[model samples]
Target chain A: MPSHDRRLIGAALVLLCGVAAADTVYVTLEKDDAIAVIDGATGIRTRTARIGKRPRGIALAKDGKNLYVAASDSDAIQVIDAGTLNVTGTLPAGKDPETFAMDPDDRFLYVSNEDDGRVTVIDIAARKAVKEIPVGIEPEGIAVSPDGRWVVSTSETTNMAHWIDRAKLEVVDNTLVDPRPRAATFTADSRQLWVSSEIAGTVTVIDTETRQPLKTISFKIAGVTPEKVQPVGIRIDPARRYAYVALGPANRVAVVDAQKLEVKDYLLVGQRVWNLEFSPDFGRLYTTNGLSNDVSIIDLASHKVTKSVAVGSHPWGVAVRP
Target chain B: MTPALALKLLIRFNRLSACAGRILLSSGIVALALFQAAALGGPAPVRRQTPAPVAAPQAVERLTLAYLGQLAEAAAVRPYFEPVVADRGVQGARLGLVDDNTTGRFTRQEFALAETRLAPGDDAEAAFKRLVADGRRFILVDLKPEVLRRLAALPQAHDVLLLDVSSRDDALRGGDCASNVLHLLPSRAMRADALSQYLAKKKWTRWFLAVGPAPEDRLFADALKRSAKRFGMKIVAEKTWTHSFDDRKTPESEVPVFTQGSDYDLVLVADEAGSFGDILSYRTWLPRPVAGTQGLVPSAWHHTLEAWGAIQLQNRFRQQAGRWMTEADYGAWLAVRAIGEAATRTRSLEFEAIRSYLLSDGFALAGFKGVPLSFRRWDGQLRQPVLLVQERSLVAVAPVEGFAHPKNELDSLGYDEPETSCRAKP
Candidate 1:
């Protein structure tokens, strides 16, 4: 065996003993009603913290002290302490808090209230739902631009992304997308927005400057049919070279050339991959697979699925701590 | 009032409960905006911001849809079912209009539904002509088979797109199929085939068919028979429900004795009106699962469907109609959304352009069935997944995993192009 493989085994042992401080990957177990914590160093699930019912949409605080989880069935955004993996508090997120985008400064939690066709903005510090902004019908995927200038809510039925102006606190523009858009994200520089449409089997990238769609990238896998390639979670590399899209049920993560806006490769992963998160150094990508109840770890450099660590039932969203 | 405006009124009055969705997200704003909306005691008003306009704004293109249905349906209504809804077909169309208008709000296009309900014995042709005369090109007919057939026969309606939202006439998809008519909901044959496909995957080959006495029950039974034959299943024994005793009071002997002779893996009931199928679950002679109209049923939409962005439609319908969305409502909603999707994509106001776009291979509408549903060119029936739901939970979705088709997997659940007798031009 290579020395690299032996070093990985040694790191796995240290993680099994639960004694080291390394990059930690947090996964929301949508079915089992818990959050699975895995050591990024070893790619082994070290802990499963029972949280709330049908937890999804996880995010780590920039300070790395708090982890926010959208406990959808419970209808509350549950905050857990990163150090102890224990739920710290529940934020009043308004009915059915499914997917949420936190402010870069951690001031507000913009959650998509699916049943209401509105976005409920919860004040993180106050633990109260401060504002309810109506968007298109069946709003699901939500995003806050890195620069905090805009909040875009992707409505599934309306098939449009509502651009909410931060200062105005109302929808300033709407970018029409493909049907049943499931996920969305803003580029690190907040210059572009990428949305994945599950039903249309395509990813739409919008130029944030004009709030207009720049390109619509449709996926066509060799053996897999079009309908099966339902795009869900989208994550652009910090280096801005590649944008990874989680193809739900197709069990593949499509890697697109972010600069060129074209699908370059498809990396096979576990079943029903729903969401993706990057490791601290941007060296690895962790994905939560809903059907297989596991998280696939992909080495960014090699662009390969390196490991599949079994987590709780129906792992949905993934977050990482440095 | 436009459905879009009505929906806004509902949101202003209704405080919707937050629910969960399994998907992806980030940003936050100051608490000042909440204070602004808090004064209204409701959610902030959703302003439909039209795209950056021209110096002289072009007139908004308005598309009006006509809904035709009877105030009272002649079909048998179960005395024991949920309270009779006043707005069944129209409500669904109204919600569909709301969604279409929401999308249209950005494109400078406005969609409206002009709903018309006839009194008993009202002339169907008069209403159809009036709607067309009023410049309504997209008409959703929720009327009975005879009324619909009458409208389809008119020369004035030949060029117009007439949508069948509530009718379940299998023959309409066959000899009576119209060139301009399109179907949104699943027919009896499709529903039966959906149930049979799930049962086939489970290897449940024997079905003891207990058909009720209603004329509609017989029709449903015929579909069940065709589906059973198609799926290679056998009706080990068949019996007509002959009991006249009140099912609610006398649960002791009727179903058990009626179902006694058949030794089968499943007892399939064809009770269209909910006359006696509700009691057949535990009352069957043998310990077998029951399915068909009551015990476990196949439907296009249900309240419990949260996956594939269905909850969004269910929520919007509930908010607008103040009730659960039914099969009729879903069909009506799909019909309008279909027209809206075509119009939005093709950016055309003309009937031929939208209709031709709908018939083309490029058109597909996301109806929250976990798949993009499209109309079949041969029969004009919407190809969609059927939900096998037991009262409280979604049991399964059909076109089960292994079921395959040359064109699409959903085609396995209904009459394929080759099997359809729709002789109208494609």
Candidate 2:
């Protein structure tokens, strides 16, 4: 049989297995003002949807209908219809919105306005900002707790992770971490919160119950200097067994045991990896490589990079929809 | 309402506790309520329905820093270059104040810079006295070694912390180290060591040393010799350039003959004033590369540096100073930023608290050099990655790959803690 027919048969087999292979991975190209959509099964870029200028920190609606992208330069979040792959509306965000976290209930979005040093809380239903909670300087990373009771904003310059009370809409506590904190993620159990410090090259795990740091996991790779191992974006596996941290400029992702709070292995990926997302079924992981302008597909079962799909210029944020 | 009444009200409110009183006073809401009540002439009812005590107000702390330097009588110029007239060091301090205030606005801290530039023949002691009398406790010094030594020896110097941003003489960090002085600029030995590491990494071990006539040039050449010895490199040939030539009138006939005796991999120029080194790169007898003070110069900061978010700093400096940031500017900026970082981290403006925080393990500052910079305890020298840059581009950053240290890799490019002679501590 010819190679083309063999590939066709392989595709038919995958589809006939009842595997939901129509999932789409959306990657925000920061410099190109667009989002590249990639087919999850084929690992091929499907289309590019034009977004607001300098769009970063993408989040899909819980129902998988609308996609929200933080347009850093435009100071707004561009809402796109996931089915149509077209922008639906623009929601006001604070100045220089670099990252955001949508609440579990999908009623509110917490956007980290880096330059403004505040987190703008927006009502998803109203599509407008409702409150601005002051945080430490240069707030970048934002994560809402799994139970939707707390929101954490990591300030890069202040080196503090602010825990904001969802009910009070005020910063209740500030926990100092390593230098240049960039990303935050909560475990599936909602008991541990992991924050990545890009410059200090460490991931600080904070206990949600006590509001104290439980451990600081440091990364050291062979042949790579400590200064170059900058941990930026973090994503916890759906089963809460492993945590993947994107070590910027190290061109690798650190697989950390979520419960043990230790780095298990450093999986080599692409250059300057920034953000990551997992497939709906947790069978694969997608990472946006900023410098290499591509996305690495990691097969969760094998814990290795299976394929790399070229994306757009300086791809930064990623979102996956089933 | 009379000012006395307001003072009386505040004193009565202070009975709650100093911290609570401060919170109420700084909140601006209490004052607004008081004004409204006073306008309505009904203070009793308003006092009964006081709003619940909210979070503490953001209190602003003010810190004042001083810049002390001397204006040279004559601006130094290269053979045919423009005279350098601008006070680059002071400009950096000013930019530092701007940067600190920017972060300050959000952190409830205000920073102010007091600049004092002495004219020629001005008594340095008198200027120090005036600054001390003005209650300036932090000083950023951009002066020669002689002047710096004189200022450090003054009676009031003990009360002030001096950040040396200009001088690179090794003796200041070694034998003549002052208890009150912290060196921000990399010493000549550090620069030479950085270059030697790069040279060793490139396998260019043999070098021809060319020393200039000035005393500073001799010191730099001595540093180069020490670096070559430390890094296990060989100095193939050495010469002192004592002759001067007018670029327009001199012929190229003697250039090749003057450099012909050397059979080395690179020519190390020690001209600190840019007098003769600019003419040595392409004019060398051997087809070797030129480095040291001119060619592949090792500096604390360079215009071509764009890594570790340095481009943001460069853009900010250019926007404020209307020019590119120079090495001296970076040194001064680092000094002021060190103070800012300490103040922000410690949340105290006390000199001792800030000083201790700066020397402690908690004082890692992001200097846009790809690493968090800190100070060496043995000597008050800022440990940073030195950039080896050409005129137009960054060639490499020092403490090259594979060079390992038992402790910090940055120690590979400078005097490590074990070898330092200075014993100053906070």
Candidate 3:
């Protein structure tokens, strides 16, 4: 081998070692039909691994070794080995698992089957579906509370978010909102939940304890059509001072003042900005611009798009590892 | 009298008084107004419905779309080649027509002539702008990239979607893209990718490339390289061929210069400028087939592409243009379809509403690519299945055979979402 080739191999090996030690977040871009494993500290996609058909929602196991991806079209949950970056197993899931939630212990997964109007609870150990909890039509945006006490699922067609008690697997309360309630995120304290409405172009703040909508923040960009700007995903910053909402079709992400319920700024990313993730250190934010076929990286402190990295086509749903 | 009974009596008396005489009509109107004032339902004022204004069909009547200069002015109206043309026959509607003389260079003398024939006086750009501003949105053009780029950059075109059926450049699909422009041509990259995919499937992994001596020829070469890298194909050898080979006495010498006896699975030619790709095909001594810009090629609209409801489209084009529609013609047709479909769905020509309907999930378009094509949010490039064609027949399509995105099945063929470099609000 030439001396330069030897040097190149040595450098690659060192870089590989560095990657192995660094925290990694594996995100399944369901629409892109691939999983982008991002380096959490770097905010860059380290590698991309292919999975089952129409993969949508993704959940990290408690151990953070296995990533579960719900392939809606294939009607299965693909289990990806984080270390090997390979699809290890496939478990039968409900129809159109567009969104999913993971239990605290990671022993069970709650998958929102959008087409079938139900949530399937899968036993992680056995790799089989254990139970099905019926929900409203086109169920999306499934999120479990940090305490593992409640599971919330949004039904787009019905425009409501159902809060289910994890233990009982029964609906404790239902909060109604404007049309096309797509996604929701809970505060660290679990006292409040923020839900984004895809159709009405608004976000509703709900008190988890009261199970009622507290406030609604409606937003619009000048020169942009009000109807086309459908909000889809929500992610709270690590400091919990602000929230980022992905405005679909408008190609922007709205930064919200968490307490005031006001849009602080609209960060222009690319066409059809749908899902987002924060870097492990909380210094950077990465978003999947579905139409642009790229990921936009935002510097958290600067609140500006620092870089745009090219990725696969129709990138949807992003995750960052800590 | 009780208030309710008094009001009812007053209303009835007003109706009776109106019929009595003109003098009674004034008294009846006054009494009815008084009754209405007492019967006010709520704090909000009653709103009167205003009739919707009817949209007037445009004057300057038919917007004339000109094709690339390669087509003869009268050729667009000929029926012998109608079935292959995409936009020729739209209900036999007679519209103003223009001709674009397609030259390999950027000189706009002929374009100037076409504009003159359109009767563009002083300030032609202003005239074009005024026409578009007045809701005459239909415009067919076959100008080069720079010309189209300039036209799209005009403030007037912000509301007008410029359909590019002429240039097949891929850069316009993403980073270099303009917001108001919609590309009709399946990019050279897309076509090359489709061809490379077919070769990869056939296990023709190694290739000998012959580049033509032209600037655009390099684009084809670049596209092939990208496809080769993407599909795990390798470039084993390469050579350049001139348009004329008068000095070369033997074909063996030319083949040896390209291959040098190195084993390659295929010979990929890049001669879009039409140098020597046609002659190089099937002339390789290695017995392997030739593909790329010539030989077994990938194209958008082929005469033999009768599958996937293409026959209907072909028939329509034949009826309109009176000839066969080429790939570029199909691109223009698809662009029109996009606007038409969006406008029909929204029931308005308002830019915002139409743009919204186009961006929505349900806005799917069938464009003879076997499946519906949609815009990628990442780069706004329309993701349509590419047809790997040869001699007016399809060999395969990329997301060919086994390519599938775990979510988007069509994503398997070309660049998927994860591979994109676009970011907005991170």
Candidate 4:
């Protein structure tokens, strides 16, 4: 009640806030049912939290105050306080929320629920799943257009990608291709979308406006089976001139010419290179090699694997600090 | 010639000319025969009638080699399959892996849909069946166990010989074992036995414990314990870490501390969760080294596994994937290799034919597992020497100095048939 007491209470609150901020770290989704919070700078995993069955698909809110993780086994998205790494809330999205994309403004989030054959849209501020848009079978990758006008999801089973207008919450077009279209990344200027066909062992380039596959670039590596050169995750540099793809069984990343849609070269990485993350500045690309249980660091400037950091077993998902 | 004389003379002349001509012709014929004989030197030189082009030796056709796994996209198995495919006279080969979301983990959707959606329902089994039903005989599968099982059970695939190349789970080998599943990856028990025998040989008997929740992890732990017991080792301390919980302090502290000092010579943490096991190393209070899931780990393949004739395999895999070898990549590679070996040796892909050949005494597969690999008659698990590796390098192999089995060396490592809890037969 006294002024001095109020000051003491305020100081304690500030200290408590500082402690929470210090302890809060990046959350890493594990292959099984666990999420590990690793110090962003130290790289030491501070604590591991068990969430839904087979926890994966992690995304931080724009303000960095909250984190949403797909507890795949439980079929729900668990929201945690970014500062404390504690579950603050949860929302049921769809059958399996494997990967998702957030809008530029961070107001809307789109998720590719692989099992349900649908994309769930969530209102970030409302903390709720707003809509579920049906897609082709085995929808895996989801990406928002640079203008935030449309969302795109790739269906593995259908070997196609569906372009949806966020306002309409409807599938406007489908870009058909070979089997197992896993990942999709938009060019920097938003003129084209690059899709990786896992089963066909090729990368399909599509016109963003027409939503039609225009060019398909295929590479045949000797000794590598056509069945195993599955292309999974994909990303384009900010300049939009170069595209990098994670080749699954191939154990390499295919660098493509953005304009020509031709494969430039394959950069080698760890065994079973799965998901990947590029530094915000696009200087370093980090890839998770599931079977090897390691993270490969690729220096983009050199376009080669610079380091392989041993991480948890079955390193699944990866995220980097801005 | 006149009358008789002229006729005689003419006849003589004609006869002489005819005789001379006959002699010349005979000489020419003789010379030709001698040259021909010389040309056809040794045997009877039997010339059989030529057959049509269809009957000529068939040229090997290029194949599309498919690989299926959770992380099929990133594994280095391409190297192993690539060289084999090239050397085997395959005209061309294309490899395809299953697709996943950005994270390497397979969602329920990806796993389920992958079964039917990967190719058409006309996958290898269907294609093999259609080909077999139409009279084609051979088939090779480096597919997962469930897929292999499903395909083998199909009536269409019955006549089409199939080779099992993946899925290392021992149950698939011993009990639930498919008559057709020819595994490329050594069973978990084989690896456990490898480590167990090594520990026994080193006289490291006492073991501390940290077990995770998965049934597979427990099985591995049980195998380790079985090997320890067979080698006269003891499990002194045991602790369980339930998933989905967290503490600010280190979870490694859950292991009880004894004032009298630790009882075990090594701490074996069977944490397959992948998140916590690496931290268990060097964190244990014990003065000795750790084993099992972390510390000194036992695996079928490692990228740094260069010794014991594994350099070639390592080189091939690195060249293909541009990365070191992972256990799964090796497993997949072995599966494909097993099929190739069976296909080439037996010259048939008939399921029964390949199975019989693979089970025969002559079938030995050279995986990158440091030794010749084969299946046990009793359990059907691949008999292998497990590599005990530390810091990415192989430290030792199993069937340690003193641990001995009457029949096979791999038997020295895991639960013997006599002590077996797995009651299934091969």
How are the candidates ranked when ordered by lDDT, highest leading?
1, 2, 3, 4
lDDT per residue for candidate 4 within B1-426, as digits (tens), equals 122232222220100012222333344334333333332232231232111112222333212233322111121122223232211101001111121111111111111011111221224554444445544343435454556667767777544444343455656665565544445555666676777677776777788777877665787777667666655778887776665556645555643332125567887777654545666665566566777777788876665675423654555455545556665556555544454445444555444665676677656564434234666655556666677887657788665645545554566644456754444333
What lDDT score belongs to each candidate, Candidate 1 first?
Answer: 0.81, 0.80, 0.62, 0.58
- The lowest-lDDT stretch of 10 consecutive residues in candidate 2 chain B is B12-21
- After superposing candidate 3 on the true structure, give the runs of residues whose Cα lies further than 4 Å from its correct spot: A1-25, A29-32, A40-44, B1-426
DockQ of each: 0.36, 0.19, 0.02, 0.01
Clashing pairs in 1: A95-B17, A95-B18, A95-B19, A96-B18, A96-B19, A101-B26, A101-B27, A144-B26
Cα deviation of A187, candidate 4, in Å = 2.0
Off by over 4 Å in 4: A1-27, A37-49, B1-426
Q: What is the C-alpha RMSD of each candidate to the true structure, in Å?
A: 7.7, 10.0, 20.9, 27.8
Give the best candidate by DockQ: 1
Leading candidate by TM-score: 1
Give a tens-digit lDDT track for model 3, residues A1-322.
Answer: 9866865665576466553245666666656678777665555767887788766677667676777777777878888887886889987786656678778687888888765567888888898888887565457788887767678988654457876666666554556666557888887767678898775678899877666789998777865645446788888864578998998778889999988878999999988888877765565677878778788887666577767777777677665545
**lDDT tens digits, residue span A1-322, model 2:** 9866865665576457655456899999999999999999889999997889999889999989999998988888989999887888988887768789999899999998765567999998998899998776568899988877678998776678887767666665567787778899988767778999887789999887666789999998987867678899888976778999999888999999987888899999999988989888777889999899999998766676989999989998999999
Better of 2 and 4 by DockQ: 2
- What is candidate 4's CAPRI-style docking category based on DockQ? incorrect
